[model samples]
Target chain A: MLKINDLHVKLEEEDKQILKGLTLEVPAGEVHAIMGPNGSGKSTLSYVLSGRDGYEVTGGDATLDGASLLEMEPEDRAAAGLFLAFQYPVEIPGVGNMTFLRTAVNAQRKARGEAELSSGDFLKIVRAKAAELQISPEMLKRPVNVGFSGGEKKRNEILQMAMLEPRMCILDETDSGLDVDAMRLVSDGVNALRSPDRSFLVITHYQRLLNHIQPDVVHIMSNGRIIKSGGPELALQVEENGYGDLLAEAG
Target chain B: MSEIAVKTKAQQTPQVTGAPKAVTALDDRLAAMSLPQGGFSAPARAEALSRLRVMGLPGPRDEYWRYTDPRLFNVPGPQPLPFDAKAPESPLFAQRDTLTLVFVDGAFDASSSDELALEGIEITTLAHADAAGDHWAAGLYGALEAAGQQPVKRPFAALNSAAAADGVLIRVTGTPSKPVHVLHRRAADAADAVWHHVIRLEEGAELTFLESGMVGARSNAVIEVDLAQGAKLHHITAKRAIDPKVGLSHLFARVAEGAVLKSFSLAVNGTHMRHEAVIDMAGDDAVAHVAAAVLGDGATGRFHHDDTVFITHGAERGESRQVFKKVLKNGATGVFQGKILVKQGAQKTDGYQISQALLLDEASQFLAKPELEIYADDVKCSHGSTTGAIDEHALFYLRSRGVPMDRAIVFLVLSFLADALEEVEDEGLRAEINERLEEWLTSHA
Candidate 1:
């Protein structure tokens, strides 16, 4: 569903490469996890893949289901079934949670040539999905994450991912600030939306989130490239042994 | 209600008409009209007019007049007011069986107004109310005078009092499910017109008032609203005056106690227009929600200058929320400054204010200031003001999606203004404002 080839991305007007010689592929009907220490460019890959501005594509290509994503806009990427769950979601005041979600979902649906959902139907689905994600009605009424706690924001991100139902999902540190209960609730939300035909690349520094939404393959990323790939056991190994041993081994 | 009296002495001046000198001569002449004598005559009017005259019209020196130049009042043409003409007509609110009060060039139009069939409501032209010994209107008029004991230094309010043909005074003793719509229309020819109105909502009464201004020539106006304890009012003002060379100033307001006052002011077209709305929160648990959207284009300047809310909280537990959004294009300008004053010992007062302006061209400009003055630490108050061009990224995002530059700009502008629009409770009024916004955007595009 998603693929990147020798992608070398850098900040606009800067020579410092943020994603260097990075390559990965998440084929349909499969799940992949990318684990790395801080500054390993995991979030950078997600941002570049999502086509956020200010990040220049220095080299290589990225595609979604065979179509080029690097050439698309951020909203276009979203319309093309690509979702990036941010580590720290942006707070957009004056834009209600329901309003923002509706715009995003409708934008994607409109781009896909599907009939837009009416306000009534949209509300029904949002309520159902929010309930499953444990997002209270009051929370959905607020401005997008305006005063939300860190864990609630993360969970709200998961709720959006579920609402969007993207073809390819990238969770960037989805468990960073979550407590045990919130972590489980967020993981459960993601796991509930998982299916054989849909693919997800959950990016995190810890292995705890992986235990809930187990990935078929785990890739160890360092220095902007994937150095090793292994089964789910590799996540547990990293949790117990830490990335210090992996860096030494990769060297 | 206690009677509030304002004493006055009018300086004698001639009322001149025609030519630039003649214009000032008339301004000075009108400025010279003495206060009308006893028994509801010139003395009462003089008191209010002179008080307004002393403060003088707002000039560039006033901080509030920084962006909107009141000097537009100086014109080299015929004076549009004090003209002899038939009463103006309105078809917008005619379809609904509303208690209609008609005012032409600030003078009450008894022949045009409709008498209400309901009881417990007193609806009459200010002329008739004044003749009927209605002292309530007198007490409320010029009540919010500046310290100089003037009606207001604003030229429009001054003109409204100086040449006010007549005004409509309405009082609701009990809540009226149906509302009274005051349609203040200007004369067709090139004559300056001025109108004044005073509306009062008695204790426990509620009403929704629709007030708007449409002027063919230069016009000035002042309107005041008082909502007694437990009274509620929803006020909507829509101004569409398209003469880029003409100017108008409006000072409209409301006062509430343990009451609610919500207002939405939309300014889409005018040569130069400024509206100052001050809502006084007097009683405990008083609430006020005021929002305004000003869409300006071409050289036809439109100013949604200021929307202010004064929450006394003297009674305790009061709240005020104000939001203002403006879009400036071509050489148009917008200014918004809002302040919330929380009185001492008035605990649990919550106040929030936000104002933003979008400048679309180098010639376009916007000035915004949001302030909070709190005397109690237990209060929650916050205010934010921002002025900037359209978000380049969001513009690019829309354009990259195949939306043309013009359409994308319109979309972003509308989205930027959506917050204020959503605050309007009336769906019809909201739709009208949105349509006006679209019209302005399309013209500029």
Candidate 2:
């Protein structure tokens, strides 16, 4: 479970306020969706939660399982069961996909005081998860995200999530740039990984991904603050009417 | 030509046991042909020898001689090892049924070398080939001597030309069922050494020549390779010199039309090592590739390197690529100069070059210069050079993942050298090079 309290964040260099007086909480065994139009600071919130550098926390704190996540480094946050599926993944040449994934998985495991997996067992787990996600082995052999198409990169991010088995996973614009069929495959992969002890924060600009993911709670954000929250129907309402009404209510 | 000042002290000067007078006369004869008197013919050979005389023996002042000082052999200089020096026991060629040619201290060790049993392949020493009226063997001996009339500052290259008696000549006539392996080594430990090796790949012939300088002896050598029409030659030279005061090495190569020349030089040790390679794309559609990985530690090591590739349109549609990477620690230094020239008539020429260096500490040094001259408008040519320390972010990333500081540095350093090592085609040879790399990192770390 994760809780964010009165979080106020500003741009590091300019000190321009982005997230002001925002508070949210997601308990275990639940799915939450944050929907907002462009420039509403939805993506910024995810980055701040994950402890990415260059984001100043002007006010409150973020906690993971009662532990302060704000005090941890980006990698430390990752080791403490936090994963962020980037909107645009950086391509690192000469670092093979399989090698990167293995390093990340082992790093988290070591941080949790678990023994490292052998090469044979690691290959077995990677192959099974790749097959389920329809990712070819050749993709795993190339450098990390180098020359991968939009949909394939997204699927790879999901594959890493499945391999890591993090406690809280954040998906930012996961459905963008994906064909309808690819969207379904990715949503299916995410749904399969859902469990009682794990939670997901699915943030997107459109309602198309909701058709497959079916989040338990939907929240509308405006200018970095949550303006409305309701059941799954809230997503359908926003999709039919757009964010015009929500913007007015928040203002 | 002035009396070249041998950089080593008088005591360690090269004392040619039987041929001291011959070397002295040769040196004086070269001096008499000085440019002031117009006695020197200014031929490629004359220029090369004069340059060698000037370099004498590399001293410590030359920036390129920093890590590898030739002064340790000061008292005796360099002397050709006895032709009868015992050859070390190596099973490299015995496993593959390859034609083995052995050389000790720059002279052909005929008793230890085996004759070629393969059909249509002629593998013989330069002396034997010349004795059998092999005109090609004599013609290409000093063919690639540095063309410019520049003063010779490298003593080993000059010594190799002056002292080389019998060199190895490998000629692949018809397409071979298996590649011919030529192993030229400097195994003599007591004295300074010189060996000249020449390999020619004739028309439409394909061959792989594996040359390893694994001998820990002090050596000054020249290796010249020529490829005829459509001939393909892959040359891999591993420089693992262990001696503390050995001079540098100079390598020269010439490639013809539709001919493919690929070479990789691995310099892991040696007090002062310099590998200078010049390639000419004489025929249309010719392709040449040069790759090297150099590692230096301890005292200042020098890699006075040069790669000048000329792609002429008369040999239209030619391609040339050069990649060199240097990894230096302690107070060692590296120098890399790469140039690609595309003549005006050479349309559709593809030329690319990249030189990168990674310095491990503040005391270490790295310098890379990449140049490109394009006269043809349609040609695609680009050159890039980068010198920097390791990525702090990546290093931190590895360290936070539980890898200790030393292991993390090794990972990043090896990743930088991986590009050049990939050019090596043989799996076994690659493994050997990697083993040396691992040892170097562990010892230095």
| Highest-TM-score candidate | 1
lDDT of 2 by residue, B338-435 (tens): 66777778888888777777778777666555567778788887777777788665564444333345755766777788778777777677666765
| Model 1, position A120: C-alpha lDDT score | 97
lDDT of each: 0.70, 0.69
- Least accurate 10 contiguous residues by lDDT in model 2 chain B: B1-10
- lDDT of each residue in A1-251, candidate 1, tens digit only: 78899999888977788888998999886779999988999988887887767888878999998999998866777778888888877655544688667766776788889998899999999999999988999999986677899988998888888878888888989998899999999989988888877899999899988988899999999989998899999999999999988999999
Instruction: Name the best candidate (by DockQ).
Output: 2
Task: Provide per-model DockQ scores.
Answer: 0.12, 0.14
